[model samples]
Target: MGAGHGHRLHYHGHSRLHRAPAHLKLVALVGFMLVVVATPRELYPVFGGYALLLVAVIASTGVPFGYIGKRMVVEVPFVLFAVLMPFVATGPRTEVLGLSLSEPGLLAAWGLLAKATIGVAASLTLAATTEPLDLLRGLQRLRVPDLIVQIMAFMVRYLDVVTAEMGRMLTGMRSRGCDPRSPRHWPLLARSVGALFIRSYERGERVHLAMLSRGYDGTFRL
Candidate 1:
């Protein structure tokens, strides 16, 4: 369904980045992000270099800028929260564009912005290049907590099923002449959402049970 949520889950044709081992990519990304997160806030040039590296990676992938921009919107909440550090963080106030800005806040914001962007970019790039299954294998090989890897594996596998189920529920409601926009229908719509949540919860429980019965453990050998 073309990554119905607007996230690019599929990769395009042959590229050197795509051919790289997933563990190597993951390690490189983690190391790069560590540098970004560890750099002093006063080092604006460091952040600039990080951004340039991200741009180069993106360019190498042949992914559209629009796709990156769209995915970055998901980071806005973190960005906004990070931006607030300047107002409330304890530090010397400095004049920037004639406005007093918190010195600590400015640094905090830079730190967060760089870390968040680099992490997201690296992650999205990885996801775009590798299949979901390969990504899971990479994580496992990297010795990511088995539980975390399992959860991620399950989530990636089931996300589409959940999305389809939700879509069907929405379709059923629409087919029944449900007017979600009507004030009178608000209660019904709310109930539908609640029911959907319940159904999803139950489905997860059942799936877990089934997995247990099938000799599933903390890790899948495959």
Candidate 2:
């Protein structure tokens, strides 16, 4: 993949995975996830096999497990939802650790967690090895909608900018002795978010105008 944007998830490397075609990696990712989703929840050992495949790919990429582990926090919500399944879902009960959990729900929870973890890991692996611009170009190669691809391209390009803006806003709030996370100051936080959105929208307009001035033709040329 040709270098373009510096991404937090992208590891700078010259490994074979980094050298692989982005469109092919995207295809393989889709295919791998399909197999994972299709597998029966009761086939516990098979899920382990899927995990081993991911581990092997990850190892070959030369990216540290710790580097990948940090980004795995994105899956916390899925983990939480999976943990609640056995407690709330309707099914025959089984006692384990002195707590009664629904038998079927346990299986469902395992399947959900396993699939979600594998999917996220696979995606992060791709992100670590492929440049953001290359990934977008790959989507274009796969015939995804031009408009959607354009949106994704812009989002990836400007994500760090938006994040920096948010950080500044939070710092400004703190300097004013306002707690952004506290319930009492939530109104201030809400207004800050609205203000941020308007600012970002205006910035986008200016960027579009600048691009048009430079003879941008709607399609990304690389």
Candidate whose lDDT is highest: 2
What does the lDDT read for residue 19 in candidate 1?
Answer: 81
Candidate 2: tens digits of C-alpha lDDT, residues 129-162 = 9999999989999999988998998899788888
Off by over 4 Å in 2: 1-5, 179-191, 209-222
RMSD each, Å: 4.1, 3.4
Worst-scoring 10-residue span by lDDT in model 2? 1-10
Give lDDT tens digits, candidate 1, residues 100-173.
88987888787788778878877777778777777778888999988899889778877887777777887888
Q: Candidate 1 clash total?
A: 1
Give lDDT for model 1: 0.79
lDDT of 2: 0.91
Provide TM-scores for the models.
0.78, 0.88
